[model samples]
Target chain A: MNVDLIDLGNESRNAGSFVSFLDQICARFELDHAAYAGTNPVASAVHGYVNYPDAWKHHYAENGLHRIDPTLLVASRSIAPVDWSRLDHTEGFEKTFRDARDFGITNRGLTIPVRGPYGDIGMLSVTRDCSVTEWEKLSRQILPDLQSVAVHVHDTVMRSDVLSRALRYPALSTREREILQWIAAGKSQQDVGDILGISHRTVEVHLRSGREKLYALTTPQAVGRAIMLGLIYPL
Target chain B: MIIIVDALNKDRFGDLLDEMFKLRARVFGDRLGWEVEITNGREIDQFDRLDPAYVIGLDDEGHVVSCVRALQTTGPHMLSDVFQVLLDGEPPLRSATLWESTRFCVDTQRLCRDGNTMKAVSMATCELMIGSLEYARRSGISDIITVIDPVVNRVLKRSDNAPYDYVGSTKQMGKVPAMAALLDCTEERINRVRAFAGITHDVFANEDTVRDLLDARQLAFAAQLGESSEWMAAILSGSEEALPPVLPEDIQDYCRAQIETAQTEEEHAAALRLVAVLVRERVHPAMHRLVFQS
Candidate 1:
């Protein structure tokens, strides 16, 4: 394999440029598709650009497949790139793979996990529809370069203004933070309200607002997010 | 003494690896302020997950004083991934016989804490150099492409273990400028570092002896911490509430070793206090699952 050094220094910075970059990578490496997903540390939300079909994207989100997507769940936790073949064909995998095959997406893929300084994780997943032997050869040949590309994509996305803003901690009021901290320390809503010299209903209102700001569904989830973002300390 | 920790034997040296990560956190995260992830007072990154070999130096009390990470160049490495800017427009070096050495650091505060001069640092540095080169030579590795700062580059020259060649120009990385230097894994280079450090005997620690010593220390620490063998067995057998969910088994093992080998009463108390702080903070969410699963 004639591997040439890839230069990303001159790549244009724009909203659609990431898609173009992924398209270029797919073309150069003879891949069917390339996708990049980065988790925003502050909100714990995932956002990225992918070259897969929009129909598949909508299907994936609508079905909440990310919750069980081995490429994301298993790959994000690992320090190394995960080969799709190495993942077990569990019930979730079968569902995802069966659905993906209908969209002409093969199971032969690799997901390279990139960890940033502040505990953020970025995954670059690429797929190729080819014979098993061909995929093995191609993956082996491109693994090193793909790893570097994964980091480049991650760093670029992390530096973007949108991501930077998302990375910023949600601004929580002092009272709200105190309430959450107390709640995390096993205080009840009434106890927090009493400690803060407020009504229980007012405490509930503050918890609701904090939960909204953190994009959490429950008070405990909001408290967890607050603790993770360093907005509140755990007792 | 120098010890090589790789994937095969990493389980046996979990405590040493943890200390090495903490040392890296101090050097790269705290002192240098590099864009590196630090969790639970340890600096660990994606590359560390790839099972890279670590050449570490431990003091008499088994404190990890100096360390460097070596990764196979054929796989993804710092030079190709994080520090590609230093490569200019050139292709990243990839070869089975060439390893990329990076994250080279020494615990300066610990080594020089007693008002020791540069002697301790230099000795440790030379010992590491000798250790990595000899290990590489034995493993059939031909050359090492290291990403080093200018200060380390100068030290390499001063110790007469300088690189034979350079690749790509230097670029400012984090708080310091870094360049890639290539060093051959040869007897001549090893001899130069050994001669410079005046280390004639083997620098590698005897694995069996080290394990025995550490095991003995762990027992002593358990006794001093008021934890009996029965308590340890209970914890090991999954006694609820005895061990905190946030404390991973490996970290608990490491703390046990630290308490056992502590030189002073204050040191032993400090180790115990650290465990308290960790349990209180519950700093790492990932460690929670590890504890529960273990």
Candidate 2:
């Protein structure tokens, strides 16, 4: 259960090294599978890394399981670590569980939700094949360690810039940022222009540009996008 | 701050979960008169037994202020189990990426004063909404089936988070007419709620923060004293006048009640020690500061 934080921290800066680290973690914990999926759900961007069987991955993708995977569905609303069996055995879940089992995904599993700053979200899941009684005992024994590991794994992946590459956000210019800041502070275009010693038309142009960059349809939407992107502060 | 508790982290949030269940009892069983199972001041049901994930909001003092429980749609949830009648016998929904959220409530009576409950309710509701969507979006859930009464639906719309669509006709479930409201877990919805609520900062607390908060609460509970008890009133309230020169016999009765409830001898001694310290601290207030500071 002991993780060499120094090694994990140093190796996480590189994508390959991080994947190897995840593999080592899986081995250390006797896990059959380990996965880290960092996604920008807003942009529909996903960057996933896992030591799961390649066939299973292909099957998951080919079937579009990402759209209806109950584990991930529950992971979305969860901040704590989750057990796969804890999910309700409702309608479509049997197929998912069956498919995963067919691909050697064990019945005993845990997924931890990780939230990064500014709309970055990810989950770290570990799966193993064991009886329910054993799974319960082992989970209790390693819960704290697993929690720590999940955070470190998330931190490593975030440091590697994999998600940033997949989910690229447009940066705002200094002028655009300032205008958006004023708008967020409740300044009208005319008021912003007057306060900044610019013309109202110039203010409008900058705001419009900012809005376009943020993919926003209106001023408030632009402000929201900017705030979410850390481009501007809210008043 | 909001804490997401699932099977892995539920152990850490045991006290908070109990608090949330009690709050649910008050809101659903007492206030709304839902025919829910209430035992020992908690409203719990089979869904809770299913190990559903809960997004809980805590105040500065670590009290449960608002909460919502999420169950995977592939399994038994209120919309499919207890309230299937609302669907009018339609085939139950089974999806991997959709979740069911229920037991949404806020501590309105606790948060409000002077008949000004609207603002408190609005703030808590908006915060919970933001927390839920943010969590949902990250977890890869695309849609949420929320089984809500008409009054709760109105609250959502008034808070600027109208459901994207309704799946079933409204039908009586328990005492209120309920329906299945489908909400998309998208950035646009989160933005709309944020703008409506005027909330700009992240509502989530980190694991370390949650651990610390829960640990402090556990210690407070172990002493059989609420964290905001009169024993520490002067120090916490920042008003020396809150404590009298000598302990009142009634206050001593309160301390005695807690001490007498201690299950173990060590716990009894610890509680007694705490009572002695509080009494001594009130008479020599500077001693309390010196002891803690050193």
Candidate 3:
């Protein structure tokens, strides 16, 4: 099913239309259920919508199923469309799966993981009750559409914090920030090593980790990004 | 195809573990002259019992062509236990999110030809790497500390997914010198390997499929060479079942020619054993040259 793309710039208006958009998605796909869950690990905020039986979402939140839900676990780590059946059936999961089934969440479904620009993880799962064979056929028909729609839904409906979060920039250690600051102030790697009382190779390691944290392409870029992020100040 | 195996699904790995251990012996004990303990033609150690995750790359014929092992850094790891000499007394780095990747090797005979480059080797190596990064990223690991030799280091750089930095100074580990190298477990790293390999799709197969494909190949080989001949019976016995992967056509022809040229029963048996191993583990095209020369 298709819904008109809402203007994300109008935050309040977009927020209000999100439920209708989700409803349209379920209606078009003939899906019995749908959900869009977002987790900003940096901010420790988990919020989502699941059009399941009443209070099920609240119960799931109260129980903190987000930490152990196999489907969400896979969605967080992979940029893939995880078939619900492919998840691990570990301790405590059988009950979760059975309880979900009790709520009309079938054994067969698909969850498309969306990694946001600021490193937030979210997923859009559409579920229906059907035999494995029928589910496979339906999946083949709708997978491409579902993947595109998942990304669209995540971008449009999910709250994004691009400027502040920068997609969860890896938190740099104090020493790492200091070394990067020195590098930004025209110090060579060897110079930093001498100043820090560590080996030059150790300095290189910190610098490399700094670059990786900032997702920088080189030493210069890493230093520049560090300064821009206020992780370090220039001389 | 690449397969991911951990303690949970390792039971479905079939003959791959045996093949990997034998290959390790060949590379470490025979070729590199490492001081590893090899018994019954297999190089296994205490680490194998630790239930480390394995990323195995198999050729189209179901032969394992490349393999690497990963262990949680928070637990006892090879670098922490045995390779302490390399660490220089620094406490082994441990974290819930950091992993140790070790035992990285490619079947040079099968993949590389002129001891330089081959399409299969490059593809297998890159695929194995992609598999490792994907596995790590999904498991919430943020970094990988691998005790890699210089040759592997160069290969990683060549493949465009080099380690971000080295952790310790180089030290001699058996015949080859090695260093602790660090690679960030990130999608960007995975993308680099994927782009270099020109792969755009997932390369992983479920554990059962891997077991079935390998079992079917071995059963077919058993059917082709029934346990009638004494030599075949001896080599194919359960105690000595470390036979190589199914042989290619040219190598089969070469083995037949060598068998015909045998002058005695003992010579024939020796030639048969050598031929069986050679066909299964031919890492390079020039291996025949070394065999003929010797």
Best by lDDT: 1
> Could you give candidate 1's per-residue lDDT for residues A1-235 as a string of tens digits?
1334233323456548888888888987889999999975655666678999998989888999888888877666544456787564556677777799888788889887766545567889999999999988888667655665676566556655565645533556565678889999999999997898766645654565465345444567678778888888878
* TM-score of only chain B in every candidate structure: 0.77, 0.76, 0.76
| CAPRI-style grade of the A/B interface in model 2 | incorrect
* The candidate that achieves the highest TM-score relative to the unseen native structure: 3
- Model 3 stretches with alpha carbons more than 4 Å out: A1-235, B112-117, B227-294
Candidate 2: chain B TM-score against the reference chain B: 0.76
DockQ score of each predicted structure, in the order shown:
0.01, 0.03, 0.03
Model 1 chain A weakest 10-residue run by lDDT: A1-10
Candidate 1 chain B: worst-modelled 10 consecutive residues by lDDT: B227-236
lDDT of 3 by residue, A101-207 (tens): 65556757878666543445668888889998998787766664565466555644434455433444446766678889888888888898898887775575566
Model 1 CA deviation exceeding 4 Å by range: A1-235, B227-268, B271-294
- TM-scores for every predicted model: 0.46, 0.49, 0.51
**In candidate 3 chain B, what residue range of length 10 has the lowest lDDT sum?**
B236-245
Over B162-280, each residue of candidate 2 has an lDDT whose tens digit, in order, gives 98766558987678778888777778889999999999999999867977986886686556545325555453344545555466656666666667676433455576667767666
Model 1, range B1-294, lDDT digits (tens) per residue?
898887545778998898788889889988887778898778999889877789998877777889999876534688768887887754465443467899999988888877998899889888888889887765445678899888889989999998776667899887778899888877888998888889998999987777787778777766665633443444445563664455677777776677677644447678776665655466346456676789
Q: After TM-score superposition, what is the CA distance of residue B282 in candidate 1 from its true location, in Å?
A: 30
